[model samples]
Target: MKVKDGIIGLLIGDALGVPVEFERREYLKEHPVSDMMGYGTYNMPPGTWSDDTSMTIATMASIINKKSIDYNDIISEFCEWYENDAYCQYGLFDIGNTTQLALINYINGNPALECGPDDERSNGNGSLMRILPLAYIKDIDYETVENVSALTHGHKRSKISCVLYIEIAKSMIENDNLDIDGHIKIACDKIINYYKDDKELIHFKRIFENDLDDIDKISSKGYVISTFESVIYCLKNTDSYKDAVLSAVNLGRDTDTVAAICGGLAGIYYGFDSIPIDWIDTIPKIDKVLSLCEKYEAFCDEY
Candidate 1:
């Protein structure tokens, strides 16, 4: 149920923003994304999802098939998505530069864990966008989450972002009494305590210490920090699944990834019923994603 709640939410958010991924915030302010429209950015149909959903599905499928976190298998599935378009509905698009480089590193024989570039500049939302499924796995740990982020975004900042995001999602799944800010505070406390000595902690000071209420201060760019900040801002500001993802998309640049990440958390907290039925009906081949979610939930239960 958590798998379906999160993944389908991610896909809806991805599909909603596919047609306006890179439009500027100023532009979106004038021309907001109100509904699922088509063909503006990618020239695809109304419900076509971008690489965000595809890579997420690839991650879920890999886990379901292997029944364990096989790093090689996971990267192989990513390769399949990049080269063969196995998980995509309308061929691959919006592949991040960092992700492309890491997959190439894997193709050129680098180990899965080492393929990602570890430099500070390599930090992007590439890894965080697809990390939701891992939070559903019981007993999943920080190192494993870090390893998965290292598959495409090896920077310490990126890894910490993924871990923090998962901890928030896990909190949402396990506790219904907490509000969004409460769940985020719980995750931040854990991260701050564990990574107290790490330099990367400075990068998250705004999220860890501040309320992130200033809409003007938020950046919805592709940078990992920016994306995560944008997600937190949108989640804190909005009260429903629709408003959360819509706010993310309207923030403009990097619309799909931010919305996808926000939607994953919003879906879990708001519950699947909170998502609009018409939005779910719009995505093509949604049943496939739903079916995968069922299998993935089963696998996590057994694992």
Candidate 2:
């Protein structure tokens, strides 16, 4: 699999939703996001990505530099982005509350693995948004995926969401012959078989059962479960990468995170060439991101 196909796919989706993030579903129904927009929520120009892409890039950079998945170094890279705006397109303008608090915990002497809050309320999409890169790593284990999610969202529910997402992405990367539903079903079956007895599995019944077609049941909120559901709903319902992400953006709240998550899968399924060139051109620092993807792909190959 080409690293840029999924990574840049995620970047384009983030840019598409940055302008309309937090908008309610009702508002977006009348004025849907059809293209990349600028200067709306964050007042930044079009094609500007948010913390989702920054944290993702930071993770890849740390892995390449350390030649391994060093949790401490990865957290330090996140701190660099949080405090110094490293890896941002222009500046640090957006971040989830859970992520911000976790970084502060790390800053105040907490260990990288212990920095995230374990409270039930801390289950935002912060970890899920950046966990896509892990899907590309060869022989990555579930425990490592959990630890990475625990860096900002330690709740078991949040960790499970990240793992399930990675499972789906890995399916796409490894099994290109399957249709979208086929890929999702394979991942869902695995998650069900692995985490069947966990209490959090109850929360994932809709996904495990492939029950995401109803729009009323899907949500576009910041909650990790809702975000995961939205990603699946958007992907299952749309035909192309552009349609999938645009469907996600129009769902409104937490638009960037949902689109980013969905776009990662769509990018892998459709290939990088399927993404619109105009949208790719609007993003600043994209060349640097592409360079990082090359380096990260090489590291994964050698790992």
- Candidate 1: what lDDT? 0.92
What TM-score does candidate 2 get on C-alpha atoms? 0.99
- Return the TM-score for candidate 1, rounded to 2 decimals: 0.99
Clashes of each: 0, 0
lDDT of candidate 1 at residue 147, scale 0 to 100: 99
* Stretches > 4 Å off in candidate 2: none
Per-prediction TM-score, please? 0.99, 0.99
Q: At residue 136, what lDDT does model 2 achieve?
A: 92
RMSD of each: 0.8, 0.8
